[model samples]
Target: MSDVDSELMAGLARMLAAGQQRRAARAQTALETLRSYERRILREAAVMGYVLGYQSGNLDGRTGIGGPLDKNNRIPPDSEILRRVIEHCDSTDDLYPFLAAACDRRRRSITKARRWPGEAGAR
Candidate 1:
């Protein structure tokens, strides 16, 4: 092939590669966003479940229907975020706001714990 033809082909190939790379990066970002939402939903559900189960256990114990509930007081601290969400966003499946708040609460707690003084696990 002529030099000009070869260079043109190479330029086209480079453009195609750049476009493919851009598309792939965008797809990856979308996937990550979806996965982040998924993770938030699961975390909120689990934390809510923990709180509910603790409450249920307490009721059962009070009624003498079962043993004491959450004797170790394992009720999650993050439960408050879920409760607030329920109070404010009642009757909706939209947990985006709740997820943001709940994750932030957890992140703050984690950051605090990491800086805890006189603790073996402290940084």
Candidate 2:
């Protein structure tokens, strides 16, 4: 989640602690919605990463095609195209296993990144 999200959640927690029941409930709902959206985006990123044959631990791999190669830059074309195709694919049932593996890879990446400051923000 972003810094703004963290602030909002903290505010909500404070309001709940202060006994502002109705407002606290509303804020809690908003927090849940924000969390759901965050999860969806991370899932999307994982799908894109997997479709491009990106191994989680190998962030320095070459693409063989011409493009920017910066860790802080946007995802490459092949990944973006693959993600689009996956988005339009009708047979999601077949993609579940791949998505699950991608999610596992993302989780591991996140865990490792968290150990180093500022790496979490890049993911």
Candidate 3:
């Protein structure tokens, strides 16, 4: 091949490598963001469980049941709640709103359940 052809091939290879690197970096960033959201979701679910009087126990890897204990014997979040929340979230943008709405609904339900039957404005 002529000098011009060789140079063109070399430039094309560099461009391809650069594009691949950019894509890889973007993928890594997305993975990290998802992991962050996962942690947040678990924490929120745990809080919800605590509010609802779920007791902590030994770590058992079960969902919708008592969670296994950590080193301090504290149970993690309820896996079932986490699974449900994640099911409704299609992206990071949806996570915050979904989590907030879920928590609010839980709060309302708890409040409604606590009222006496004849209490004013009680459902």
- Number of the top-ranking candidate, with lDDT as the measure: 1
- Among all candidates shown, the one with the greatest TM-score: 3
1-123: candidate 3 lDDT, tens digit per residue = 999999999999999999666544443343344446555766576568654554433233343434433335354445444544443332342334433333333211335554434553754
Checking candidate 3 for backbone clashes, the offending pairs are: 58-68, 58-69, 59-68, 59-69, 60-68
Q: Among all windows of ten consecutive residues in candidate 1, which has the lowest summed lDDT?
A: 101-110
Considering lDDT, where higher is better, how would the candidates rank from best to worst? Answer: 1, 3, 2
lDDT of 2 by residue, 18-104 (tens): 754543443333234334555467457656655445544234556433224434544556534434433332134243333333322
TM-score of each: 0.30, 0.21, 0.31
Candidate 2 yields a Cα-based lDDT of: 0.45
Tens-digit lDDT track of model 1 for 37-56: 65467558757676676568
| Total backbone clashes of candidate 3, pairs 3 or more residues apart or in separate chains | 5
In terms of lDDT, the poorest run of 10 residues in model 3 is 101-110
Give per-residue lDDT, candidate 3, residue 72. Answer: 53
Error of 3 at 97 (Å): 16
User: Comparing candidate 1 with candidate 2, which one achieves the higher TM-score?
Assistant: 1
